[model samples]
Target: MPLFGQAAVDQLLEVLDLEQVDAAAFVGESPQTGAQRVFGGQVAGQALVAAGRTVERDRFVHSLHGYFVRPGDPTEPIRFQVETIRDGRSFSVRRSTAQQHGKTIFFMSASFQVREEGLDHHSPAPLDDVPGPDDVPTMLDWVQRYPSRAGIFASAPQAVDVRYVGVPGWVPPGDRVASEEQRVWMRINGTLPDDPLIHACALTYASDLSLLDSVLSVHGEVWGPGGVIGASLDHALWLHRPFRADEWFLYDCTSPSASGSRGLAMGRMFTRDGRHIASAGQEGLLRRIGERKQ
Candidate 1:
């Protein structure tokens, strides 16, 4: 087992660098992120890495769809088995499944395509006069303000710098419920090498952090003693342009609907300067536990 020291970015890069165990199978270990279960984004990103390793360099990944079958054990290593579904003249498709203890935990289907020019357009990024990442409070600040949750917040993965654009669910202000939308500015905490695949994978890992929370914002729910219970069920991503993970990007997230014990969230990634870079969507199990509100 490899330890990722104190740097979150280093740990992420290490985990993404999988060890080839067979022609189409690879093994990856979890980082010491202090969570009971493995992060869903980590598995998705790593699975994409496994598939990308088997792909030709000329083709870059454009989209991926994945499902979370079961919670992953952080103490155990995950094995990724990739299957080549097709390889066309300009596109390739691959399916990757992640397993632990001989049981499937996560699976993904990814598509890659060669560079080509086409009509290009995107939704305009938000124009709110939001504070920059530096001006916003860090997780450490939250831990200090809310000492009861210090251990949990302090132990979270520190690979990315996250600055919430609004008050987080755990920290409410004067009973004012959060708006339907949630925004955060995030990027790799430290500098990363110039590898496009590594950048893409790192962004994928960061994308999952606050998506579901957007749904909670709508219902004035928080993750406290009697908060809501939620877990991601499935996720998908579409890359629109090339970008670096080390630079600041605003993750604008919102929930469109919640029903049948599930919630759907959609997000768009934009550079600080307003370049729409990517889009992500996820559906998660969102159940209200404990006593219902009267």
Candidate 2:
């Protein structure tokens, strides 16, 4: 079933609340891959939620670092183990490992801090002139244009509303341009509860969506012949400020390097008003494939 919209988001929140552990143990056995692969964003968001639960309510997650060890099995339940790494006066740290079928699939370290006064400084916000997610075409509308490739969009949990600033090139390849950056507008598809943790986790999930493609764009390889075998290997994020997830935010991504069959991309997320809320960085394996072998 399509995992997006209100139903899916509500179900995910239910699971999150009912299985309220210091860590998350989710089972996502892919009916397609037949492998129990944990979704990287899910693990990351769940880990952040776990860490947030342990800290004071006012203390929000400020940064997180995670590694993808092995492809997770979606069919089997994932066990999340959380370690309280540090609890200082202003900062707290926690480490979490997501395991499935007796094997580690994801590991993450997160830091939380009580909101405090600091010299606020950030790079000039990008895409302040772009329209919000509402003004752009919904992802579902785009998916209908290519029913055959709908699986990719359908498989994703649709808690988020993603609108590409430009036409998506997943099928019938769009204009291939060589640039080091890409832009997309995103926001929660439904009203999120007031819990700050939920907002943080939601942001965690949204951050992983399309940042890596910025790297591929630089080589004119995005949606290349047979497309690129792109997979995120590691993801890191630094939250600079707090904001509502349901509000429209622009994700401006840039690629600084691509070598050794790996590409590094960084993103800065900003509210429509030009407030820099968070920054994300990721490195992924981008191997060009000759044909659809998977």
Candidate 3:
């Protein structure tokens, strides 16, 4: 049985829990949030779930690479077709394709592996000089301090709680303060099932939350009016260690470059105790709405 906390998390769990339609296929539905488009992370997580179901339980996901082909209409249910790419002695690879309106919207290739002894080393945790979750302000605190900055995100708390270490991406361009990086402490905001696959999928969903914010932070730009709007083009992740989604983890991200209206962001997640767990990279289209296109 899964531990429980927020109703929002329960809803998120429901969204991640797909309906099996065939031997290697599943159907995922969107919550009626009246949003115009499906969240890229949501589709990616569901696709991971679909792929996970077809693989051996002992094998945990080690890496995934995904490309967002099209925007999905939130009003429609998505169908996932999982293909068994390869199942080697200690590794398994699967490809998941998400389709809506009979058209492919997103697809991912994920590889899983069984436990094995291996030499290991990772970069040191990046938050040694940063404040802990207790010191960082929550969304409510932010709203009270900078209500104007919370334009598109001035809603109720989400299943996943995110606390930025500094100015968030919602800060407009005119008021922007460029930063070298974006740091955040986040978690599911509730208890989750103990399944490793579930935790991995949850992390997959949460990884997309503020990655692009790093790109925005680079130039002190925000999202929305007077700022820039964007969409994720691709997301990739590599998990090096096991972690629980319900536990607070630090996500440290930065943007190395931007050109031709595209920005690339890279990030890593470390446990509160300072174990480096995963690394994520994404490239997205970041275009200013007021700017004219050729």
Q: Top lDDT: which candidate number?
A: 3
The local lDDT score (0 to 100) that residue 212 gets in candidate 2 is: 86
Mark the regions of model 1 whose C-alpha exceeds 4 Å error after superposition. Answer: 1-6, 172-176, 291-294
lDDT, residue 129, candidate 2: 62
lDDT of 2 by residue, 1-294 (tens): 566677766755654442554343333322233223556777778767666676778778889999988887666656777788888999989887777778888889999888899697888886646666777778888788766655567566677788987655464445556665788998887888999888888899889988887887786665535667767899999888879988889999889998888899999999988899999999998777764433
Q: Candidates' TM-scores?
A: 0.93, 0.88, 0.95
**RMSD list, candidates in order:** 3.0, 3.2, 2.7
lDDT of 3 by residue, 1-294 (tens): 222248879888999999999999999998766568898889999999999999989999999999999998988999999999999999999999999999999999999999999898988897679999999988667766777767535653377888999877776567668898999998998889889998999999999999999998888888887889899999999999988998999999999999999999999999988899999999999999877764
Number of the top-ranking candidate, with TM-score as the measure: 3
Candidates sorted by lDDT, descending order?
Answer: 3, 1, 2
Per-residue CA lDDT of model 1 for 35-79, tens digit only, reads: 889999899989999999999998988899999999999999999
Stretches > 4 Å off in candidate 2: 1-4, 18-36, 223-225, 291-294
Superposition error at 24 for model 1 (Å):
1.0
On TM-score, who's better, 2 or 3? 3
TM-score-wise, the better of 1 and 3 is 3
- Cα shift from native, residue 47, model 1 (Å): 0.5
